[model samples]
Target: MIELTLIGIGTGNPDHLTLQAVAAMRAADLILIPHKGADKDDLAGLRRAICDRYLGASTRVALFDMPQRDPGDPDYHHRVNRWHDRIAAIWQDRIAAELPLLSGKVALLVWGDPSLYDSTLRIAGRLELPLTTRVIPGITAIQALCAAHAIPLNRIGAPVQITTGRQLRDHGWPEAADTIVVMLDGESSFQTLRPEGVQIWWGAYLGMAEELLDHGPLPDAAPRIVATRAAARAAHGWIMDIYLLRRDRDQQAGRA
Candidate 1:
């Protein structure tokens, strides 16, 4: 039986590792780190650094090449599903080759909580081999973004919807929630909404050294956020960001 542990390491900050995450790292027999080419090597490097900080010498660390999506595929979901299957196959092959006996624990460090926007759990489900899975939750980008900005995720009793950039652009604002926290948005999705009554709090690289933050009325902040996001992505070759939006009226009553 292969015991697969998906540990959340939080954003890019080493301090984000929880005690449970550290314990999970130390317990694993082998940990897989995915390399996303030289430009995004910092991602793989961060995982390695986490392992180096917490794992003992007995634990093994291996690097795997992260699969890239085929740009030519017109069907986004189909292409992603196929890509996931390829990744699952890679995981199976690596486990078999590295642990031929197939009795030891294997782990992968994930960004943020696996239960959130991350797809690590979904890909792990594609493993054909008999597998036991365990997840160690860590801070999410939403939480980090809120904490960095010293704002609450939702106003007192109001609901907050967490969504992606596509949803925000394709479906305008959610009716039920006064506040929306967006993740996985490469293009400043807030630009799609009317800036009249919305306030946006944005943060990139939340817990990292190169963190960037901005907030104010949507109209005033949208331009700067887009420009800053572009510059940051260009300088680092990659970026992880999240933002929270709330209608100004929602906060008029002074709710936390």
Candidate 2:
């Protein structure tokens, strides 16, 4: 049976690796690295770096070409489903070819936590084979974002909405929640809001040496953050940034 282990490596920091992840890597019979091409990003290289640092020669390492998703497709959900299927097939092929026996453990180094804004689990589900799949949780960007800014996730008993930038752009702010954490946002979607009583805490390249952070009233901070994010992304060739938007209730009460 294919014993798959999804190992969370944390947000771009090698030191964030947990003991469980390290053990999984050491125990793995084969580790698959996804090659995401050169121009779009260097994440593939980061994955290799992690393996090179932690894995030994005994653990067979294989590189598989990652399929690119089609953004021009009319149906977004359908496109994602098709992309996941293709990825699952590729994983199966690569694993079977490298380790025909499939006797030992298999591991994948996941960026951040697999449960947060990642599709490794969904792809694994399509494996459709009887295999023991284990997930090792790691530090997520949300945690790193809060830590970098020295902010708490939720204020008192208030609720927070965790969403994508696309959703925020299309639906504005959700009335049901006082706070929101946005991920996978290419554009500065927060600017679409009225920005009356909102506070923003933003972070880029979280947990890394070149990390950037900014926080203040949304109206004042949003523009600077956008400029910084754009320039940083251009300089680094890619960027992973997340932000937390909170409405200060005490300030709201004062205004009222």
Best by TM-score: 1
Tell me how candidate 2 scores on lDDT: 0.87
Name the best candidate (by lDDT): 1
Give Cα-based local distance difference scores for all models: 0.90, 0.87
Residue lDDT tens for model 1, 52-139: 8899998999888888988899998999999999899998889988899988999999999999988899999999888899999988
Superposed Cα deviation of residue 140, candidate 1 (Å): 0.4
Q: Quote each prediction's TM-score.
A: 0.96, 0.94
Which RMSD values do the candidates have, in order?
A: 2.7, 1.9
Candidate 2 structure quality by residue, lDDT tens digits, 136-186: 999999998888888899978888889999999999887667889999999
Pairs in steric clash, model 2: none
